[model samples]
Target: MLEKPVNEAPLADVTPPRLEIRNLHRSFEGRAVVDDVSLRVMPGQVTCLLGPSGCGKSTTLRMIAGVEMQDSGQIFVDGKLICDTVFRVPPERREIGLMFQDFALFPHLSVADNVAYGLKGSKADKRARVEELLVRVDLLRFIDGYPHQLSGGEQQRVALARALAPKPRIMLMDEPFSGLDNRLRDGIRDETLAILKEEDTAVLLVTHEPDEAMRMADEIALMRDGKIVQQGAPYNVYTRPIDRASVAFFSDANMLTATVEGALAMTPFGRFLAPGVPDGTAVDIVFRPQHLRIDFDRAGQGPVPTPVDGTPARAVVERARFMGNESLVEFRLDHDGSIMKATVPAVFLPAKGKAMWLTIRRDRCFVFPSEGGA
Candidate 1:
């Protein structure tokens, strides 16, 4: 007799979300600080909240950690509701951990004691957990060292170890690397991420640095005025930004106003067909410096005056700056006084005021609705 085969669940169906925040709202002095924010963090993945100051990223993080009360919203961890209108769990009752930007290590406590402080288990179990976490953060050798005795990176690691001591379901970090020196910050970032990944801990990290967020986050949420403007993988957001502010924040791009005429965008740099653009609409065009090509000719032939095949503007080279690995050339367009920057390899450096043709890679250009503000 043949036995009936058992049905199997898909991986996604079997895996539960580690944390969820729904319609989170908070206010201060009648102004919404965290405005209807919602996000989900899967187990072991790092989600970064990235934005400039006063954008409400930190306030949202604090609400998730239960450090601040939300006027309205729901926060769940491991499929259990922790915050809602009728029920609210205090910070100590919620199984959440936080690492502040200041490191916040106890000045009088030894590293081992600081790490073991959060564990509720017996003395021996707490000591063992602390040692294990210290080893994971590569601070085992400094177990007995006080906060004052350890270097900035070491102290940061100790703080991280302490946060992990209780093995909370989720970890929230508020600009954890912002206060450290540049060199130490990079090292500690790598070390901290590795430890978190190894333990399969879900993390919600907040930062203002675009590069840092891109490098460390599995997914990124860009916030603006207490709202999430864009959220996606780093490459998607950087390469195809949905808004001008996002494009400007992600990379060095020269933004210029352009008039859409027929199927082309008219700029100082000859006319080119605006790929995927609607005709006869005013729009903002973003040209990344890296996409602008510059070539210098020393034969005194004067650089070619090639107008973009589809557009009516012409480009004139204004200045060139050699920045070690690459040369940035500034160009003036005939239609406006606005200057455009193009980044070329150092080997292609052009003389100042040299006549050079400019061409933008239409495929890489980003066009967004003119939002007036940067």
Candidate 2:
């Protein structure tokens, strides 16, 4: 027989998904709270469920953590089933760690004891683990201190160390940094992210703040009315929103309404391509406040059109206010008297009632079919 070529060994698969949820549903008084929610979190990745209040994000987290039973759903970890309508797994056995708004550290327990509470090993082994986590969190000096002796941010760090003591496969954090001051929150969040990435633990964070989601999440699931309306990377979710509400969720948005004809919607800004929208259908043009270009009015006439910024429109400054890094200028259009907002970087304060020229960036704007036909 001829010599056979040697076959290469197959590569071993790394850790399967750290967490997965399928068709999770929960209701309160016959009203669906978390309706058909599904998501996946891989090892070393952070998935943020972001939305406004009463959007069922917290409930979804609770179900995944096994704190609440889902009316119908399946929960899995590393390709192994953990929970479903028939089967059940207790919260402690699921290997899912939780960090909530309240630090919830035992007032009586020392910092070292708190971090070692969930660990199971000999005295030497548990002590080693506690010391390791305390050093990582930069709280080794407070190892013997009680929870009441630490600041809010320090308490939170201790809580985080305790949660990770057992090396949970999945971590669920519900507004964990909300208690910290604004300046401290930023630093704590970044430090926490680094530690979680080092541990390679999958994280599901719930927050109503858009900035928080954009800053921390690898993937954002935007929820509304107990349903996930959009899910994607932060840049994609902000740049290519599915609807008007989605755009407004991230930042302040301006709108222009026009009727579609020949697959084009004509507005005060310029003509916008309305492809796939039927002729005579109404369309709403949306853009962020930062997309508007401001120009000084000359002799009561606006600046000429350019390729980047389309036809200029005249408006009277209704109000202007300094907003730290930018100045917010509200205007009333000369044509329809409708209000619109624009943001100028640095210091560019215009007197109220001053005439100004505004041009919209056609490339940055989105035209969507209008439901109200306004």
- Model 2 vs truth, CA RMSD: 2.1
Cα-based lDDT at residue 227, candidate 2: 89
lDDT of 1 by residue, 1-374 (tens): 97556786545755657989999999999999889999999989999999999999999988888778899989998788989877988889787889988988888888999998888978888888988988788889988989999888888889999999888878999998988999788888998999898879999999999999998999999998999889999888888787788988877888877777777776655565666666667778786899876544445332455433222234567887788998777887645656888887765556656665556656777777567623
What's the TM for model 1? 0.89
Computed on alpha carbons, the lDDT of every model, listed in order, comes to 0.82, 0.92
Clashes per candidate (backbone, < 3 Å):
4, 0
Consecutive 10-residue window with the lowest summed lDDT within model 2: 2-11
Clash list (residue pairs), candidate 2: none
Give TM-scores for every candidate, taking all chains together and pairing residue i with residue i.
0.89, 0.95
RMSD of each: 3.4, 2.1
Candidate 2 per-residue C-alpha lDDT over 339-373 given as tens digits, one digit per residue, 9 for 90 to 100: 99999887878999999889998889988778597
Off by over 4 Å in 1: 1-12, 270-280, 297-317, 347-349
Candidate 2 local lDDT, residue 331: 94
Largest lDDT belongs to which candidate? 2
